[model samples]
Target: MDFGVTPHDGLPLPPRVTICEVGPRDGLQNESAVLPVAVKAEFVERLVDAGHTVVETTSFVHPKWVPQLADAEDLFRAITLAPGVRYPVLVPNSRGLERALDLGVRDIAVFGSVTETFSRRNLGRTVGESLEMFAPVVARAREAGIGVRGYLSMCFGDPWEGEVPVPRVLDVATRMRALGCTEISLGDTIGVATPGRVAAVLDALIASGIPVDSLAVHFHDTYGQALANTLTAVRKGVTLVDASAGGLGGCPFAGSATGNLATEDLLWQLHGLGIETGVDLRKMVDTSTWLAGHLGRPSPSRTVTALAGTS
Candidate 1:
């Protein structure tokens, strides 16, 4: 099907979009180089200064699982939390939630999976067991009036289980919402999604009483489809998009997964389409370039490479 927008299609593009910058958390977590807590703190500060309203700062997952972000508490303590900017952290379970609560985190996210294989592999639990584990976490966070975001991964396709159906994604998404998640981020984990599939998933969600405003899209550029998929989502009235600076993340567990949709690249597309993200493109590119230097390599972001001469 033609994914291009026509005036008569009854699909008006969003005037503005909120970019949830996941560079410091998701981006850094998958990297081979473990940056210092100070550097990670600076990265969070830089993203906020560049006009990112919501930034995923760190994960409270155990050190054994993700050693790179093991200093979650230290990083949270080091960053100077700015006013009016959200700094959400990922909490794997109640223990993770306790750590975040101890540090006074106002926003937290729970990661879930659509496919059983990914759920088992990523969380070491079956689909039901994972949600069962998240039940109390979500309940506690809601009780404390914290903003909870549910990230549903492998929404389009999974590495172990090839193609993921729309219903399967909807089931997990619905459960997550019922569990008191304020927002649900649909993750194209391996980036195998195309415009058609993107539309199908959004359509299903909207038809099932899920509001478009509460939905977010997280796409990977593994198959070079992240931008196209994002455009399709925006045309469908999705206002929140998740991206990482310098294209710096992949699923360490899923070998087929590649880097996330680069924040710079997504900004280039959104700005070109007359969408307001409140993000300064130049500053974002500069931040990515600086980060690439610390990582001892150039950024994988096309916009960053083209504008900043990171090579």
Candidate 2:
């Protein structure tokens, strides 16, 4: 319980970090067992109860492609939106954005790939075509006075095409930023990023005139380097992080990808370092454990398992 630690000299870590909980949307969509709408609603509410300010509620992709989140509208209808909590949904295109807008959603995100292969596999379009698809969505969202987030997957590496070139990643990121994306989340979709690579990518972005405050990091734990990569990003001045509760969810399109960095585990590390996130570690662990039970499995988060005493 005592997370006190002596200060390290000149640590560039931010004093506070904002955790964007993606369990309800990103986490549940990849799940094989489709949970009831009420349960998913409860999961989002519980995350809010645990002091998460931003929770990705669901995606508006076609039900045929992602059946797990087909109940997106139903889930929104079933849940009570807490005041001051930002619930963003994923919108794959113009229609997806329309669906989100119909539900009175204030924030929406568009997913893109930095590589041509992943763009074709995931979005069914090439990288250039996907960017063209997002341009209108981002423009309309901004015109509607809605906040738009751009999710660039495979920022570190890709499964089909191997390690993606840094220039290609930067080009897509710059394009997204030009499209009026208020915030951009860099995704380690395959969990192949190390601390050095993380730093290099972030530094490149910074050099390209991307503000650190406008950037967020989303890392996976496939190679057990997510925490280290996240820490490196945080120290490089990124405050926003995307994580799934219980370390749930992987890229369905990328077979080699693994679960995201767990909210509980990220919280444990951030809180231990005396960085404020406003999230209750105990409540987050409890939320993860509760959701794990519904998923018929134990939590994948080390912190959750240790805190909840679930083997």
Candidate 3:
């Protein structure tokens, strides 16, 4: 576990990276099958056992919008919350926030879109309107001693809006920070971002006085550039990255969107680069393999596919 002297493009990489595993929440939300609440709880426990310190548990969105995770409250109650590990759930509005607070949840995430079209389509509000809606939720969470993680989706590209400008992404991110979000995860919803594009976006955010420590990269594997783009972000001093266990979920709003960057795939790269993630790759692969069976499909992760001999 010695992360010794790993440098990329002359930039000193972090000795350890904090990976927030999004499998239980983001990964399963888009699946067609509704997994039992107990199964989802087991999935979260397995991931934490594999050394993921931060695991997104579930979303409090209306069951009508995402029927798959309708059991968010039950799943949250079922998880055996480990000491020193964070279990953040996605809260779309004040109602969601109220539900999480009722369960005594400490960490929660709010999602916002950079593009107007996507904001309206996904959340049924304009970009400004959605931010306006999240403002009170963020404020209320802060008042209740809860930490808020902001998710800025469609940071690189969007299906309806095409390519999104860096400033537009930065604007929403800045607003989230101003609204009391502890960290903002920049999401490549369509997975079209390359290394250069990732570098440019990170550079812009850093140049605008947004500390790299306050940001996390969430890349999708749609065009298979997720790992490369993530590497580019790490090179730019991004210490936090988001990945799913089995590369589980896709964007319901974006037609061409695919699963997220797999935890096993990202762990392989991090371990190869001598960066400490504290994750057991084999265990993670096994967890994904187990969950894949429930979904009745093979894991979308390259590392899992290779290790499980399913390729």
Best model per lDDT: 1
Q: Which stretches in model 2 have alpha-carbon errors above 4 Å?
A: none
Candidate 1, residues 1-311: lDDT per residue as tens digits?
11222344566888899999999989999999999988999999999999999999999999999999999999999999999999999999999999999999999999999999989999999989999999999999999999999999999999888999899989999999999999999999899999999999999999999999999999999999999999999999999999999999988888989999999999888887778899998899999988998999999999898889542
Ranking by lDDT: 1, 2, 3
lDDT of 2: 0.92
For each candidate, give its TM-score against the true structure. 0.96, 0.98, 0.96
Q: What lDDT does model 3 reach?
A: 0.90
In model 1, which residue pairs have backbone atoms overlapping below 3 Å?
none
TM-score, candidate 3, is 0.96
Worst ten in a row by lDDT for model 3: 1-10
Q: What is the lDDT of residue 51 in candidate 3?
A: 93
Indicate the residue-level lDDT of 253 in model 3. 75
C-alpha displacement of 110 in model 1, angstroms?
A: 0.5
